[model samples]
Target chain A: MTIGLYAPGASALHRLPAGVKLGALVAASLALFAIPSTIVALAAVPVAFAVYLSTGLGLNRLILELRGPALLLCFVFVFHALAGSVEEGIAAVARFAALILLASAVTLTTPVSEMAALVERLLGPLEPLGVNPAKVGLAIALAIRFVPMIAEEYRQIREAQAARGLDRNLLALVVPLIIRTLKAADDLADAIEARGIET
Target chain B: MTRDVSTRDIVYIALFAALMAAVNLVPPIQVAFLPVPITAATLAVMLAGCLIGAKRGGLAILLFVLLVALGLPLLAGGRGGLSVFFGPTAGFILSWPVGAYVTGWLTEKNWPRMNAVWFFIFSVIGGIGVVYLIGIPWLALVAKLSLFDAAKGSLIFVPGDLVKAIAAAAIAETVRRAYPLMQAAR
Candidate 1:
């Protein structure tokens, strides 16, 4: 559930410009969609993995981190193949894998603070459009940070529900989760106000 | 009227993003008639939009999209990346922000009672329609099918999406009741 990439490295990849990395990621993604070749998409994988390894982020940890999604990706490939042709399925799988690898690299390399700062810088130009660039940037950063926390919260709720012998129905999961989320948001808003973050 | 987003807000956004990604890794529900499997990720998108408002909601989806772009299999049917955007479901994938924006915009409008009618309309027109607009054409192009055929393929999703819209609306209304401060902040 943790979306934050926790690679403890100070490599060059970690030092590259966030904007540049973002641009490259976007460009690579676009290339993936435009290029229909399964082979080319497959080729992007090792190259991405190479970049990951070059970062000195533990390859074993990286692989372990990716294992869950990798398994899921395999399932998708099989499902697609069963649903359609092998070529199309493989192409789909490759494109997906490339995207995952590239994003993991970005998250692993970029710290949250830097990411927030980068977002602020990126959105700075939008202020003229009546958009509060700082607020927007803050919101994005918060969203990134909270994603994992919420996942943990949901898991806790599920576990708690299971302890009570709840059948793990969607309602059982979603209801308590939503209630807790609202409570969390309330506590959060109060804490912010207490800190004078808001007038 | 301006309020600074705090650390907690950031944490909420990140947690929602991760939750969405995690849910997406779950197996998509296979239906006999539809080409695409039904996944709860869209529900997450709607929830993100309803809860986080427009900008953050959109950003949250962007984060999820970026995660997919990074090679995480955090998409419907455990699919991920830019390639999903080129597939038959690409339109829907792209429509996430639009859907969130529309839903958030409607919620922001602050209708009293927050009834199902407004919710249904906004979710269907703004949320679902935007998704189909982007998705149908892409599906048509990729599948090399006629516009009509592509539109037909999208039809399979209508019932399911309607259900999602209703659910999103319900969740949204419930949140509105539970968090009165959310409205005040707005």
Candidate 2:
């Protein structure tokens, strides 16, 4: 459950530019959907797994990333079976699973900063249309920084709820969490302004 | 629009994006009788728009989605990366920014009044209506399920999502009264 985790490695995939990795992902996704052959789709799954292994992150890491999506994959498969298109079900699951694995491989290897830079570069042409690549970069940096802070804040909220013996339902926790988040945002925004940071 | 993005606005946007991440990571709540646990991640998306208003709300969500694509495990249960975009719920996930935009746009219309009823309706329109509009097609056309089948499959989540929409409305009402953002919300 790590965010923007870049597993350092000297593999070929790791050395590839973030833009290329993303571009290839788009192309690969398109091909997966466009080709109707179940065989090719099924074949792609293992190929994706092999590439994931090449990252040297181990089988456990690949499984860890795919754990969330695999349940949905199982659902789609069941849906297809119920609809009497078991073949399509297998193909659909294979297609998605392959894509997830391949993408995780690319993301696991690429640095978050590199990916942010790629987005800024991609948005470079839009500067004339009033897009600020610099601001986008800044926002990305700030979000990355805030992720852990927000997580910590949630921990405190949970602790407070437990102390009060409040029912730890979504509603009970979310309201207080939102209030505090906005409060933090207010102070952080002021601190940023006081520091004289440009937009 | 770009020129108006001050450092303060950027911080709000970034923090909401972080809020989405934080909510996604929070353990899904298990209502005793429900068959499955409900997640607050999507609820956070709804709350983002209602609390921050349209422009910042929309940008906050878009920024969060982009970070997920950058391979951060910021999604629920620590899921992240470009792989998420290829899932069955990809359409719903991708539609979040627009959903937040619509929700924020509606919530800001009667600003300072804190009308919980109207706020609830607006949240439903943006959170449920807009999301289903985009998500259904992704499942029906791209994923090769029948429109009815896809729609039927999605019905299971509607009740829970409605609850989140209601929560968003109530939260907006409370925040307006308690904190007030201390400025023109929009």
Candidate 3:
């Protein structure tokens, strides 16, 4: 199963090299803060949405991406309004919201594998520093692989806790979760060892 | 314990990193008017350190952070990517690996006499003290709020974090008695 936010499309955004898009993202983020004009910062939000929309992702998809940060954006506005720095608040919110939109755009358009490859390549230069880029990439893939398993374990443990009278106790919930996480890790380790995938 | 990261160590790191992602799916407690909600994901940071040794624990969290930056919706409330780096709580988010590292380092140092109290103390020191050390200043700078103002909003997370520290401490002691995962790495 496809585990991430990647939504396939043939749009220019989708066809754009993952590394270039990521580089643009990093550059744009730096520029957002480096520029002092709040208006310029706020203006970038629409541009980000435009890029997002160009991916054939639609306005609804773009708006949905904003839902999580929307609350925070509102709070940011209100906090700054109270502090008598509404313009500053708007700038901060705008910068973050735009970045969020752009990020989602990148993730949705780019396949996880492509992104992983980009990361590995980016880390390649650090190999001399003893950073094993391939291992790091594999670890990331393995971590993603483990997510569904861990979520299942979390659910089972929560259910088990509820079955007893210990549902409300934090320790009851936490202790077994930790134990099971370790157990799962141990089993996976033994499997990897048996497979002789040299570290 | 050898300097080389064995296959077991890699799996442990990956699993804990996965644990971070999975924990983010837990329902977050939204404090009205507060941008960042209280989350179990942060508790997982403590668990990463308290369960795994320093090196792997820290690396586990570092791995998670890299994935988050890579645009995975691995954070609570489904927030991730470069967007989070620009957000007000970016400081706290970035501090996860450091916090985990400190917690694990302290845990390792006190392993011989490990108990709930030591676990709690280390978790608090690393998870709370170290995290907010970076998080608060970042919040203030990014949000253009005064230190006092930034802290006022951030203090809300403290009560919940303390509770998580307690849970981590309890789990730490229980794991030590029942199954010490860190021992294998050592």
Which candidate tops DockQ? 2
Cα lDDT tens digits, model 3, A77-180, are 77788899888888888888888788778878887778878989998888777778768877888888888888777777767877996655566765777678
lDDT of 3 by residue, B1-186 (tens): 123777788888888888778767655434332345535566777878888978898899988987777667777757666567766678998898899989999988878888999999999988999999999988888777788877888898798788778877877888789886657768
**What value does the lDDT take at residue A88 in candidate 2?**
92
| Model 1: number of backbone collisions | 23
If scored against the real structure, what TM-score would every candidate get?
A: 0.63, 0.90, 0.89
Best-matching candidate per lDDT: 2
lDDT of 3 at B147: 86
Write candidate 1's Cα lDDT for B32-131 as tens digits.
Answer: 3334443556676677666667655666676676556444557654445333543345567777777777766665665564665666677776567877
Q: Which residue pairs clash in candidate 3? A: none
Regarding DockQ, does 1 or 3 come out ahead? 3
- Model 1's CAPRI class is incorrect
Q: How would you class the docking of model 2?
A: medium
Error of 2 at A157 (Å): 3.0
Which residue segments of model 2 deviate by more than 4 Å?
A: A167-172, B26-39, B182-186
Candidate that scores best on TM-score? 2
What lDDT would each prediction earn against the true structure? Answer: 0.63, 0.80, 0.79
List the candidates ranked by DockQ, beginning with the highest: 2, 3, 1
